[model samples]
Each structure stands twice: as structure tokens, then as C-alpha cells.
Target: KIPEPAVAVDAVSITPCGEGFPQCDFEDSAHPFCDWVQTSKDGGHWVLGHKNVSIHGMGPS
Candidate 1:
């Protein structure tokens, strides 16, 4: 499992991408943005990768 952190961010674009990984499990399906954030915040498993984004107003812009 990846190490969980305080928070995570999906600083990437959600628009049509050329290629990507297939949604595997629950986390992959739900968190189309960033899973590490909620996962870590929820006290679940830790995520290794970190997205550079502001935790404040992490909602749809």
C-alpha cells in the first residue's frame, strides 16, 4: 500500500486525455479527481503520489 499523507489534490485536467489507466476499485471509480486526499484524511491507506494543488476549495471550479 502507498503511504498516506495529510491531503491530496487532483491538479490535473479531467478533460479528454489521450491515454490513462482503467478504473480498478472503489477508490478509482469514486475519486476521479484525487483519492489520496480523502483516503488519507479518512484515516485509510496512504497514497504515494501527490498532486500539487490547494486543499482549500477543492471542489469543482
Candidate 2:
């Protein structure tokens, strides 16, 4: 199964930052919900581009 919507979006946006974005030492004033990030891409037709696993209702703490 695919992951949650957020994770996929985060993964795609964050992966280019070195696969450890948010968790890494990269500086960012955005991405407050970086803790709940999970990303996976399904080349198959079952899912959309990248699928993510993450929580909702989270923001900068």
C-alpha cells in the first residue's frame, strides 16, 4: 500500500536536499512537520508518483 499524502510530498521535496533533509543539518525555515516523514515511489500504476507515510495536524513546535 501507499503511504500518506504528506510523506510523499515531503520526500519528493526533501530528498533532493540529500535524502536526510529536515533530519539532516540542512537549514530550513520551512517544513515544520519534518518529524513525521516517510516517502516511497511506486513505478507501478497502483499508486501515484511518490507515496509517503506521515502524521497529520502537526506543525512547527
Candidate 3:
């Protein structure tokens, strides 16, 4: 069984990207944006790459 969170989560605070906010281009940087975090609980995770992805038809064009 899943354990309940210790504190209430406020989902309404989330927002879309706006001016002055740094976009998630997944470029040069080694990590995700400050507001984001990396997790592999599902046995899969994000990989940072350049130009194109290794798996065909999977990532950016």
C-alpha cells in the first residue's frame, strides 16, 4: 500500500512558462531546471542528449 504524504499538496500553485523564466531546453547544462527534479522510481529516467536522441522516433526532431 502507498503511504500518505506527511503534508497536504497544493497543485493549484503550478503555472505555465512565462517571460523572464528560463525555458527547459535540455542544452549544455547537466541537470534539469531549478524547479525540476530527477527521479527513477519507475525504473526509467531522463537522459540529456544533443541534436537527436539515440532511439529512433523517440525524441526531438
Candidate 4:
């Protein structure tokens, strides 16, 4: 059986991105944006972080 509360999960974005997503430098630097996936928390979920966005979860849906 599954435990009452499982371990904590977290996913960090790849390069060209900040902890909360940085600017793309559209007309200055290379690599506009970044993209990644998180599977440790809920079975391979897409993650796209914004400048000032927060994601909250309540266990299972």
C-alpha cells in the first residue's frame, strides 16, 4: 500500500532560464526561452515557469 504522505518532489529548469524564468534577450543574446519536464512529482508533467508565476498543488486531483 501507498504511504499516507510520500516524499517531496521538485524540478529545476534547464539552462538559459532562471529559477523563476529569466528574460529571453529577444534581440541581444541567443536561446530565447527554455522548456523542461518534471516526472518526480506526478508522472512526467510539463513545466513552464514564468517571471512571476507560482504553482500550487493539493496532492492528487
TM-score of each: 0.16, 0.18, 0.22, 0.25
How would the candidate models be sorted by lDDT, starting from the highest? 4, 3, 1, 2
Clashes of 2: 2
Per-residue C-alpha lDDT of model 4 across residues 1-61, encoded as one tens digit per residue: 9769777669766676344554443454333434232437666445554444434441123
Give me the overall lDDT of model 4: 0.45
Lowest lDDT block of 10, candidate 4:
52-61
Off by over 4 Å in 4: 1-39, 52-61
lDDT of 3 by residue, 1-61 (tens): 9988798767767677464344566554665442333336834443333444222222222
* Cα shift from native, residue 60, model 4 (Å): 21
Every model: Cα RMSD to truth: 15.7, 16.3, 12.2, 12.5
Against the true structure, candidate 2 reaches a TM-score of 0.18
Sort the predicted structures by TM-score, highest score first: 4, 3, 2, 1
> What do the candidate models score in CA lDDT, each in turn?
0.43, 0.37, 0.44, 0.45
| Model 2: per-residue Cα lDDT at residue 47 | 17
Compare the candidates by TM-score and give the number of the best one.
4
